[model samples]
Target: MSARTTLRARWQRLAEPTLVRRSVVSVLLAFVLVWGVLLCYIFMTYKHTITNDPGLQKYGDALLVSLQDVTNPAHAAAAIDSTETWTYIRRRQIGIFPGKTLHALSDADGNPVFASHELKTLNLPPRHPEAVGVITEAIAEGTVYRIYTGHNARWALQVFEPKRTDAAFLAYNGRFILPYLLLAMPFVLVPVWLSVRNGLKPLQQLASRIARRNNDDLQPVGFDAQHRELKPLEQSLDTLLARMRQKVERERAFVQDAAHEIRTPLAVITAQAHVMARSQSEAERTQAQAHLEQAIARTSHLAQQLLDLAALDEAQRPTPRDLDVAQWLRAALAQAAPRAMARQIELSLDAPDSLTTRLDLPALESVVHNLLDNAVRYSLAGGTVAVGLRVDDGGTTLQLAVQDDGPGIPAAEQGKVFERFYRGPGHAASSGSHNDAGHATNGSGLGLAIVRQAALRMGGQVRLGQGLGGRGVGFFVEIPLAARRG
Candidate 1:
């Protein structure tokens, strides 16, 4: 293959949907979504917990105690400035400390005594001291702060840090969280991939078993599926195999029967040819020629019947078209008129002036021709052969019946008449006899089989019954009108 073709094939394979790919993708998406939700939950919880840091209150209390011991205003200011400088230096040196803190000292009258550099420009208000340190939120110049207040008898001290924004927190902490999440993914995905592969192992094995089977091995698969999901697949495969086996058996039987039926005519033709070649007089040659012709005719008829049966078996459902069935029946009778006349059999049709319906024309033609041929072949000379077509079952079904005044099949043999190449007990002797027209009355024993199969193909059925005057045989074919009507 060309490079482009190979690439295209690969792309198509990837594009095709597969169960394993779908399952793995679904699991991966769920994993990512769950991880995202967990991250959000952790961020919210940590934000709430850090807002009331206990260590901030302790720092505030210590600052207040230092301020109480300094009575001089300059010394008090110096003490506050010293504390702020120390906090700044420690924050810069230690990674664990807050990134920024602002401090302010106030007297008992709530006047600001001193303020750190960052807080100096802003107006600072003192909070009322509580017995226990209290943490609260305050907003100054559009910046939110988490504030802790502490007080002694003389001085109240305030220390606060700017509350971290969501974006700031993410930037600061994402590096640590993201690496760990990345590290954990392979651990999770490896197990998931293994589980999915193992889960589908049974399906793969089933496919391998099917692939290993030979074409002639139409037996049901023997694999004992352990999974609930695999049972339906196994059953369906077995059912298909069973059907195939039946079809193979039927084909084998048909071939055997066809060979057996053709052999007799072939042998007769061979013998007659030998006789003609060896004949010394014109009469002997003529007799041999006649016999040869008869064998050829029988062989041709049998071949045609075989072809008709095979067509019925192999052809797909035919498309239906509007057909005047009554008119069609008359035409069929006209075509069969020569054979009927030669046998001195009177052919009659009983149908409406105009009966139109949708039908599969070829199937209908096969049915009518086979029935007429069978009737004419079996009916005695001077016998009446009748053809009938009518809409019955309140116009829902079309009934076609052909009857002949000849020897009818016995009740015991009637059921077997439709079998392929099956002739009655005395049919062989009768088949060799000639009619008044010097034409052999041989029957291929396939006419009724063809009729039955053709009727079935048209969604109809054929049944044998009493003929005209109740003395001979009749074939009644009933087809559903509703099924084929346009």
Candidate 2:
């Protein structure tokens, strides 16, 4: 597809319930609602008007009586058309009996009345068959007939108003009604538009603000809105901005610190290499070589820290694999065994045979390794570091906790430990005084930060507290349980 066509399609997809659709649907719904109410009002008004019209009801009843009197066989047929008799009735009853016709009846005693032969084509008897049927039914039911019957011989009375001459009355109704409907249409349109515009104002403002934002605009969105519904949206957007700002700031600080750290080690290596070049004694050469090795180790440690940070950032979803949490923790403990031995810390594992948590193995392994590594590094010789696993509520998660019997963190500082490059006072103390060249080292202090990030990516949480015996810090990681393997 052409670029323009593609763009149009994308916009069309996004524009469902657009301004046009909203306005149209709103107006149509308003029209229907108004029309329905008008219909009900007209119906009620017409019923009431008809009921209250004393002249119309009185005249109609008189006309029906005249027609009934004419239908009787006892009143012998005059040579004159019954239409002439109707004239007398109509003038007397305010034109109610305009005119009528007569048909011979089935019963010798009864005659039929109608205005035209067209009406007789319906094959209705002298009286309506339905009316006669009702009288017969009443007699069978042992109920009194409310309709005129018995001596009247079941003659029917049907009334009709002339459509041509009465057109003026209908025209008069429209004359009063049409102008009102037209005038009220604009009034309805204005309010519906205004209410919708008012309702969408905050969203419009939000869109405008977002559209105007540049990459450098990290300021939080202000909440000077008058609407209550908009307040939640404003607060949520501000929260998102605050989080994004913190992430950017952390990344920037990490870069600056990493550069400074790498530069120092390189400076040390360069200075040592220059000294080794000028040295003439065996002792000087040995000292220079040892300094160079320390610089190389520091550079390697910095590189590892950078790698861990990237891994944590990249972690979003876990690969589909059955990860045994207990087994992974055991493997991590075994890897940290040497470090724990050097620190004279006891590595204790308390796990089920095949406890599993749903996660990517590599990312999950990093979480386990980092926590245990930190625990062993900080603990005093002969102190115990324990790792344990248990299932959570709903049987849907595996909770892993690593505890060390070293100096515990103060409650006030527990929250800050998870921040990147933040190290507890206990770890800093033992880091500088250790004996083994590789084992004594502390890299960029991102171990706990990595653990927290990994936990978040795995849909888990990391909490810090005192150890099982309240001796040192406890690092807890909780993850959802894996699916059953077939």
Candidate 3:
């Protein structure tokens, strides 16, 4: 492919769900996290202003005291007009009061002091008899007070700050700060964003390096992340790559080993066939033919095992369906019947009248066939091999078992039996007959391995032990009933 095409493909791969999910989650979390911190800072400033304003509190208190002295007319008027308190009052008034008008209650005659505009709007009784009661109670309660009222209503104290001035102050601040803020934002955002992007540069480089790799290249990821925070992530990715590389190497080795094993039998068969054709004596020809047949059988068995391994390696999940366990067990018995008869071994079925299970057809077939073959192949001639199928625990468990009169495996070696290519200790002694003529040895090991893989794929387990009816090996499989489907 062209370089441009390869680059495009790499970009597409980077758009995979894993990368997209990580990027979106990181950005969203960062936004919420930063905004949350800023909001907390603003809340702290608000609390400090309201709580620590001693000067403002004192002014409010003095205003309340003045409002309480209503009996002395001269003192009340002087208090109302007192220039000594004007600085305190104006500033406090500007800070606390938002409306265009406020009210002052005189202690002398219960009169009100207000602006001219307020007076024109509110022509009330000499004493604002309506406010006298409310203001008296409010002052007595010592609440740093504010009241909301219309222009036509009489109030205790009235102060007005021009709306134009308030608007101008806000507009002036906004105008003065806007250019600088606009200019500073790029500086702030650019550096932080660049720093963040730069910090993430190693990740991008690592991705690019990974992208450049061929399908067969599962080598460790190569990148020197500069930041401490990125090191752990790089290390994890490196570990993952190492594991993947090791798995690929193991699979390659297995394929090579299988090919070598198969090739030997095929070469022997070819040689034996050539010898049979050239043999002049009937006896020699017959022996050569027999050897050729054995070699062909071994080759065929090896081929079958390779195919089974390939099938078992497929990652696709099986489509499970409910099946009658008794019926399936009967079928499994029928499959084993031929091998049993060849050895004159009696095969018997002990399935209940009706039982059901959830299973994938092909996978379940492999499981049954392998277990039955293992049982019949290992059993002594004239031995009885019994198959059983039943439901237990209100149909939650569908159990299938096959038992044969053969030497059982040791308990300690049971775990190792499931491993690929693992041959039991007494496999040679257990073979019982050289009539094993046209069959496989390695095939036995592969059969059990395939059985385990299939059982696990169907969310089930298989176990080996002494038979329920005999002192020989019993192969049993269990699948959860819930997986069953109509």
Model with the higher lDDT, candidate 1 or 3: 1
Which sequence of candidate numbers ranks them by lDDT, best first?
A: 1, 2, 3
Inter-residue clash pairs, candidate 2: 101-114, 344-382
Residue 445 CA displacement from its true place in model 3, Å: 4.0
TM-score of 2: 0.66
Per-candidate TM-score against the hidden true structure: 0.64, 0.66, 0.59
| Alpha-carbon deviation at 222 in model 3, angstroms | 14
> How does residue 57 of candidate 1 score in lDDT?
73
Ranking by TM-score: 2, 1, 3
Question: Per-prediction count of colliding residue pairs?
Answer: 0, 2, 12
Query: What is the per-residue lDDT of model 1 for residues 331-361, given as tens digits with 9 covering 90 to 100?
Result: 9999999998998989998898988888988
RMSD of each: 7.8, 8.3, 8.7
Checking candidate 1 for backbone clashes, the offending pairs are none
The Cα RMSD in angstroms, rounded to one decimal, for candidate 2 relative to the true structure is 8.3
Best by the lDDT measure: 1
lDDT by residue for model 3 over 132-195, one digit each (tens)?
A: 2222212112222223221222224433222223344444444445565556555655556566
In the range 45-119, model 2's lDDT, one tens digit per residue, is: 765664465333344355444545454434423312354366457655753322332223222334442344434
